[model samples]
Target: MLTLRMFIQKSDVISFKNMEDLYSRLNISKNLKDEFKSLISELNDYLDRYSPLTINSHEMRFEKLSTSEPNPDQLTNRELMDIYLYGDYAHLDSSKRVRFERIAQNNLFAPMGNHVFVTIVNKLVEIIDRAVEMNKQAIEQLKDQI
Candidate 1:
């Protein structure tokens, strides 16, 4: 008997696009065509990367803002000028947004301070959610076959 190990391989990114593409090429089923394509699009969007800003509350007048741990760093003058930083940077002005986008694309700034670390954490969460969704959809499809 083939072991479960035989069914799965390492290095699988487990995106909807990969799954749909693989099954469609094999001509899995007519009923699954539309649903599979839609799932692939959703999965692709979830996996797509978006740089976001992270914020930690320092000492605040409000009790809600109080935190025992403080963020490690803040942006430097040079970093603030970069465009990529705007991906996560929140500003009312479009000009500032453009500047940050330039900074990020240039890779001119390093992730500094508590806010940057928070942004990293947030991105990690998004990654996990996408992975989970992809795996779940794949598993459900497998179950239908069995």
Candidate 2:
């Protein structure tokens, strides 16, 4: 039932910076926390290694860029990926422009012409899906126990 809008919501993404924080927010049991931590660690490593850099509002040329922007420092990996996936980058600096071009080259026929961005976003979505499935399994177990 999760829509793209829901998945990319800034408010929803703000709570989780890393797996430990996510576990805390979900109130995961200590026993399962370790497992989830391992999975999250792997996902984090992949994101760190492969995710694109995000351009801040200051870097964006568009007028009407929000006066109340989300803290750049507070953005989660998924949020960062979302920005890279969806934000306009036509006005990026030289280095960022080069990087964006490389991404575009890799995705020549891609819907958005940004294969790296798409790959990272898909991975992030997978991580969220896994977390949701885990929560559902846990809830079902609790229901059975009751």
Candidate 3:
């Protein structure tokens, strides 16, 4: 899980769609708009099996922010990073360590099929890229104004 965390830290975001949606719904930041699109693309690519970003941490945890609801909980860019930057599914269960190891060793995301695994990888990458992009743009803009 710690490895995953580091992977996410080094990984970059380039989309602001989710960020913009959050802002529009919550009035957080209007500046993340343009960067969000690029982020989404970047994430989509990063999470792919061929991408350089991969899990490496042994101790990662996902912090539950709110009670489950019909609408997903709102996530800031940093919070979003927490999700992908953490452990893989089996990390949640110690009993599954052996099973998880098998999959990990084989580099197979799923035993039944690779499609679902691919989809998840893509999703995580997409989300991370989007958030990273928005955050990057905001930092750049701040630097420019200074």
Candidate 4:
């Protein structure tokens, strides 16, 4: 995740965030573009599903956020990065640490959050892998033509 934060995320977000603009700049074949479009759509969906934004973190709960709520799962992809960056991995920001600690101290978030965090993270990794592979193949094909 650190590597993602430092290096890959910059490019990863750009490549997928606005596919129409990026696609307009590319010289990919029709079939390849279609495939890329589908992949990008799915990738973006998962990316949206899992974000680093912490706005909704306050609503997260172990079993459920509220008894009246339908899903109860408030965990977002955005909140996971905080746990890794502030709570566990870097552990630098005092303010973030406090927030993360409060969230972590929750009876349910401590254990179940780990499981949920890892599962979604793995899915993100798999999507990123596919995007990287496709980009590499496209670039290599372009190189061959040159």
Candidate 5:
């Protein structure tokens, strides 16, 4: 639910994009859209160094993971993040069946991947919370003028 609300774009749902716009319209100092992009960029760097895969995948099954090193060739953290978000958490994408299945069957990294994903989501919520807090006093004053 939080995944969809934060990542997915639906007309009926209030997403991070929507919140970004709202923050802008409310004249909040921070640009939320840019902040989100920065967060993703930081996450990508971290992911490249330490992938979602566990250090001890050698102890478990390796059939699902084709390569000795986990994670697909040239597949960015951003791509995997989107795949996991849509395929497992929120709405299903028929077009992503192949990639999605790859992610689903990889049980060895599932726990670590899920933990990282949840942490990302938590960080997003924190950013939003801070944005709201930063603008609270100004917003309260604006309300009185109206």
Candidate 6:
């Protein structure tokens, strides 16, 4: 039996695009698909709420703001999610860690804080677990028929 821990330990950084590829390869069910979409939408909403000033500004202001470069370490929630999903958290630079800590301290973001990020990751891992379980069941059934 595949436990969540085992599954996560075996996983690599799966980009958003790559997740779609995995879904195709696994032939994931509609329920799982909808759940994945909902999780993604929630992540998007969080990102929109906490989006950096540059990306959140008005179009007219963009031209002027465009001249000034945004801090590469000033990541959106989505970017942070990507990092958590695929990147080595332990290896993250001090700057990125500080930036993430700042976001965790934000009044608006504090309510959900790190929990939301963890929840999304856990949900994705659950999907993978379910897929593996389903595959095992199918294999066993096939064996029974033979």
Ranking by lDDT: 4, 5, 2, 6, 3, 1
Model 6 scores a TM of: 0.38
State the lDDT of candidate 6 residue by residue for 1-146, as single tens digits: 12322333325344434454454455446655565555445534654332242122211111222335554434444565544433335455565565555545566654444565675566556566555554565456457666
**Which pairs clash in the backbone of model 6?**
13-86
Q: Rate the local accuracy (lDDT) of all candidates.
A: 0.40, 0.50, 0.42, 0.58, 0.51, 0.47
Local lDDT at 142 for model 4: 75
Where's the lowest-lDDT run of ten residues in candidate 3? 47-56
CA deviation > 4 Å runs, candidate 2? 1-15, 18-22, 25-29, 50-86, 89-113, 141-146
Model 4, residue 144: C-alpha shift (Å) = 3.6
lDDT tens string, model 1, 26-80?
4344555665566545434432322233222332111222234323323322233
Tens digits of per-residue lDDT for model 5, 35-130: 544544454464444333322323322224343665434343445556666666567776444466654567765565566566656655665565
Task: Please rank every candidate by TM-score, starting with the best.
Answer: 4, 5, 2, 6, 3, 1
Tell me the TM-score of each prediction against the true structure: 0.28, 0.47, 0.34, 0.61, 0.54, 0.38
Pairs that collide in candidate 2 are none
Residue 25, candidate 4: C-alpha displacement in angstroms = 1.8
How far is 62's C-alpha from truth in model 3 (Å)? Answer: 26
Candidate 4 differs from the real structure by a C-alpha RMSD in angstroms, to one decimal, of 5.2
Give per-residue CA lDDT, model 4, range 30-127, as digits (tens): 66667777876775565445332232444644333333433423445555655556666663677667666766777755665566567666776776
Stretches of candidate 3 exceeding 4 Å from the true structure: 1-93, 98-110
How would you encode candidate 2's per-residue C-alpha lDDT over 18-134 as one tens digit per residue? Answer: 435666565446666666677677676765442223334333211222336543533334544544444433223455454344434443323333454566667767877876776
**Candidate number achieving the greatest lDDT relative to the actual structure:** 4
> Which stretches of candidate 4 lie above 4 Å from their native place?
6-8, 11-24, 50-60, 63-73, 90-96
